[model samples]
Target chain A: MSEPIDRKTVESVARLARIDLPEDQIDDTASKLGDVLTYIGQLEQVELPDDVEPFFGAIESVNAIRPDQLTDSVDREQILSNAPDADGEFYQVPPVL
Target chain B: MDLSTLSAAELVKRLSSGELTAESCTESFLERIKDRDSSLNSFVSTAESAISAAQAIDERRSTGQAVGALAGLPVAVKDGICTAGIATTAGSRMLEKFVPAFDATMVKQLLSADAVVIGKTNMDEFAMGSSTENSFFGVTKNPWSDQHVPGGSSGGSAACVAADLAPVSIGSDTGGSIRQPAAFCGITGLKPTYGRVSRFGLIAFASSLDQIGPMARSAEDCGLVMNVISGHDSNDSTSAKNDVPDFTQTLNDSLKGLRIGICKEHFGEGLDSEIESAVNESVKVLESLGAETVEISLPHTPYAVATYYVIAPCEASSNLARFDGVRYTHRAATAKDLTEMYCQSRAEGFGEEVKKRIMLGTYALSSGYYDAYYLKASKVRRMIKHDYDSAFEKVDLILGPTTPTTAFKIGEHTQNALAMYLADIYTVSANLAGVPAISIPCGLTSAGMPVGLQLQARSFDEASLLRVAHQFQLQTDWHTRRPNA
Candidate 1:
């Protein structure tokens, strides 16, 4: 198996994912993550053809753009209705400054 | 006659003939949900608008106005699909109170077809787990056995149909999410070809793999729903441009001289002995119906689970990034800064399984690990797709068991994530290959739990998949068996 994911790496990943994991769960999280990585490490052993292309999505016609035109939009009140904190028209967020 | 016992197709004939009113049919389902859903926990929210809609259909029919295909049929939709003014939580706490301002494209189609929207069903949180145990609401119990899990993230959709709470329900499948649950609950589930059904309103799990499908009592019932839902939509760019065909037209067609491929890889290693026997028996029934079966090889099948784990998480990590505190519901109250608010809100909102996948996906797509994990897995995905493409050259359909075993008890695999992930081994390849597949109940295990026989056809070939499944249901009584619950 490849090197096990260390707690430091797990912590860094949580930071990158923007999830605030608690300190005590770090080691447990790292172990679980390592288990998954080890399971997926089997892919490294397969010899792939160098010419093969990496697939990002299914094969279908691309650039399916529609003609630009004005269309009906959802009501402004309905759109903001689900916001946790909305000022009737605008969503409220923590001040960046 | 009990309206709940009739299939969607049967209900359509009755409603059209004026033997039963849509209002009465809607009332029966609402009454059943009230009586039974307390034990099953299949529904997240029931719609009062469903009754009003059914009443409108009755009014139209009495006034001699033409109604749509599924006039008056009450159908449940999985919570992941947005409904205008209805709470679509996706079984997660993060969107506990979030209601969409507009209906999902498919929901709009369902409404236009004049079907009553009964309620939103439960599922795995963010469509993440193999069992419904991961839902923030609570685990959905299998209709066959309350102690066992209804396989997820479309568990509620499957369970509701099996329990006769709804004649048909809509589900979204990423990796076997629809089929596995259908197998566990003893019903029919279809995962249409990728982009066959528009995903405009579906909460993204793995955008490349996620496809909304139909779950119902029989293949014919599934086909009826498929007819209404499968079509092109300008809103979903990935939605196929292929013309929608009448899926039920070939239900009675002879399967004589059809070539069915039996992949050796699907039947070996870790598969339950009872399930193996049942699936083998299903092949015999198909052969007896005048179809020929041949042994085929999908050598890269072993890599599907691993490749899916890498690819799905990578997409999910990106898709879920929109759940930050700036938009929709759930914000951290104690955060003093912008970054802290984002972090703390997500940490509190998402469940354990969702957090684990997010982290795994973040690690895989990290700057240094990109080539080693995400890109490598993508190449392997191509090989998996090629395996299906080459096999289809020699056969019309590929057959296999839907899951390795029947439904296990709730909390069985919650502690071990890898074990839970393996439950999708037989179901993921079709998703990775972007093909149409269906799961129909074939037999019951020694414990009386149901086993699903899966049939996969070439991409955009749901017509063939539905035809074959319909024929099999006609020959066997398996799909007719109902749980004692």
Candidate 2:
């Protein structure tokens, strides 16, 4: 259905999603993802009223904002305890040149 | 009496009365988990703190310190909900070893209500799949049939209740994660109105569609759990500011003159015959109890699955981007650069289904495809909500089969992800409509597998929804039957 999402497309989408797909697995991934997209493609048949606005979430309420004043936060050391590699004050990551 | 077999409400009552000590109560359940869960695989990790916590609760009760609502009943939490000092994986390898620093708002509420958090239940990896097969942990088997799947994402939660591993559980539903599993496992599961419960520490799936709710053996237990969890929170902007009634207060309300809608489209193709008869019989039972059944239509029902796949994964892609190995969870051992680190860590950390969904979402939200996919699905999502809005005017609640069939054998749909997604046809619309829906066992099929009857009501109408389901349970013995462990 809809050409099984060719390997090239899988490669492109994987890049966008930031998941590195090994070359050997690309074809299988494309086909499986393609099957789901093809089913989702059934949406093409539903004719909607031209005036209907796209609904995002369940709530229609305006954003809830709070005072900008600084408040108590989780302990920095405790929060950093979950970090993969944390230094004294910050998380360690691959250095960007 | 096996303490594990009692409802969460009964356990709370007995514990508060000092008839059952919290230590003995927690230990009995911990024993159940220890003896039974090895076969069910319902728990990813059981808490070692449970006994000591129960001991503290016993001391508090003995000292005349006021006990909270739950009274120290052990409640299983879906792995996605953060539990401070406990490993919360969401069944993904990405967070396999990551322990949270703080409990989720609901977990905090459970603690405040005097419930003991016994364990984190297994789920589909990142709550992506229909079966629990996608968990980084091993697959959770249906207690009724070992070869079959416990319907997923919330499968382990359902299994824990079905197997009496825990009297009640917390589960998050994005699509049909909670309802479908509960249906397959023959337990009661409620997906409260989208904002009825706070989502402060739920590991996000599809933010809009995801709502945390309860799973148990009966609607009364679900209502009891809902009482402890539902309410607006300052931390969750989307949580409704509406007044939350005591969820359990209305459980015994009469169903006299209640209006139940029966949608013809729901009983259409792809449904199994046994499920059809079970639900049809349930409607008759409801009518016998003075409820009225009206024929209604949810015209947009056909488009729900398609719309959900697009919206859920799109939200998921954005939500899961936080897992890119820099902070919490899995990081790649080797990466040449930051981009490679992000890509490779995600590639290695996530399971196939999670990655596939992320890719599908990225493609849908990609430059040219956004209007055609995400925007169109959103508009159809409006129509799905509108369908519910129109139906609610005709009837107080909508009833249908929770899933097309009973528990399917594990690995049956693993290779066919789309087919697995289609199994959620009847349950996803409730999420799309942002209404409250519940699944309760109606009867067993000819094959001896359980069938779930689903009911949906207008948003924030969980009280009425629970009341109606509880009324049905009062007249039905299906809710009382459990798999022989």
Candidate 3:
């Protein structure tokens, strides 16, 4: 049986998603998730065929394919326009120290 | 005249034959956007460059240069896809300033095929929320109804297409982003088998689950765009090496003898009664078209949302780590240290929905809970896939409501995260199973909102799915209906 999702877990998820959620909303998310989980739990009761292979997120290739020939690309300014911070051609970041 | 209501294939022919000039078509759309975009808020950024490009294409065509498949056919892109010299905000404040110098692989493919790039459509920030309300820019209203949501994170693409602001648009789906919106907006959308299209320039959300696909007015148009962008790419190692098919070529194929599976699990409790009827009616239409309907059971369907919630956020958390203030996103006005800067930048850049997902994902992968949550979800995902494989053995395709309901009022599900996620209940399994799926308008809901029926097929079987959809489309005028302006 699947366990009930709780407020703590919801808060944890909120933090992971990087949204700042008020503590008040945590319980709501958990309870709602619990209901959804309950709905999904019904599937566990059903039997699956024996020959089925597990579904993976699409397929993966050993080596990424690319054209062998070199080609000139667009300038860096065009790529960096949306960057929050940039210095010349490269993205700018705080010093590691 | 509603220039936005024209189909891409039709527009392509008109432009090629000199019946319609690229400049005129571009101006018509620009005029439409000017007149209508304020109410729908579908576009984030319009491409002035595209107009010039269309003009240039016209010049080349006059000089005897061959016009490509999509020549002068305008298409919008979701905000998440990087466009050369265009803002690719991903609907988050984090990349609010970030722009890409190079085009994404899919964008390049469109350009090479002479597809006119129109503008960037809005979406849920980082494709996190199921409703466009999660966008930092504010919610995109459904064109069908001002009070309803367009669905997300590709809601902008769907809404814009539905409103006829653009002939077609490109969108990404990580758990039904494109399909759900297409369903909500009453248009056509395809989520090709994962890796069917290259992911080179798409910002990673759930890296494993994210895929770029076509959204358009009809199945044939989706196939046209799919043909140009579905090939494997070197930039994305996970892309399939399968031969790209001429999708439109098979659009008119007979649906005779096709086997479509109707999943009992999908229609169980939680589905809107109206949506169920719409889908059932569609299945009936397909049956009348000569395709056989078989009842199939994927008992594991229920577990998909649970499995998806765990997996998508976990992957999202990992992928989003690159956006630390020090790295790329918004930085605090004053941060005492690097760690604080990272936290604050993230806190400010991400919308509430995005943050919730990240936190859920991070906790799922955290030290003590990894096996219990992340690993368990992975296992469940595998089981879900297996169920699909088994079902496909008996049927050629699966039919269901792309969403459990029509587009809900914008604020209806925002207060309830679970309810919002449930909207994707009928659509997410395809992402987990890595199969191709399409959503086509079937009927209008009682509220006058468009209802979409989702059709899914086995991996690499897009031709079969499109053929059936096209056949159904030919018989019914659902796909041809445009929202009244």
What TM-score would chain A of each candidate receive against the reference chain A? 0.91, 0.90, 0.65
Consecutive 10-residue window with the lowest summed lDDT within model 1 chain A: A54-63
Candidate 2, position A13, lDDT = 92
lDDT of 3 at B370: 73
Native contact fraction per model: 0.73, 0.81, 0.48
lDDT of 3 at B315: 93
User: Residues B1-485, candidate 1, lDDT per residue (tens digit)?
Assistant: 78888989999999999999999999999999999999899999999888889999999999999899999999999999999988999999899999999899999999999999999999999999888899999989999999999999899999999999999999999999999999999999999999899999999999999999999989999999999999999999899988989999988889999999999999999999999999999999999988899999998999999999999999999999999977778888999888999999999999998999999999999999999999999999888888998999999999999999899888888789999999999999999989999999999998999999999999988988898899899889898899984
lDDT of 2 by residue, A1-97 (tens): 2345888889999998899999999988978888888889888888999899999988988989888888778788888888888897999888766
- TM, every model: 0.99, 0.98, 0.92
Give stretches of model 1 more than 4 Å off: none
What do the candidate models score in CA lDDT, each in turn? Answer: 0.92, 0.92, 0.83
For lDDT, the strongest prediction is 1
Using alpha carbons, what is the TM-score of model 3? 0.92
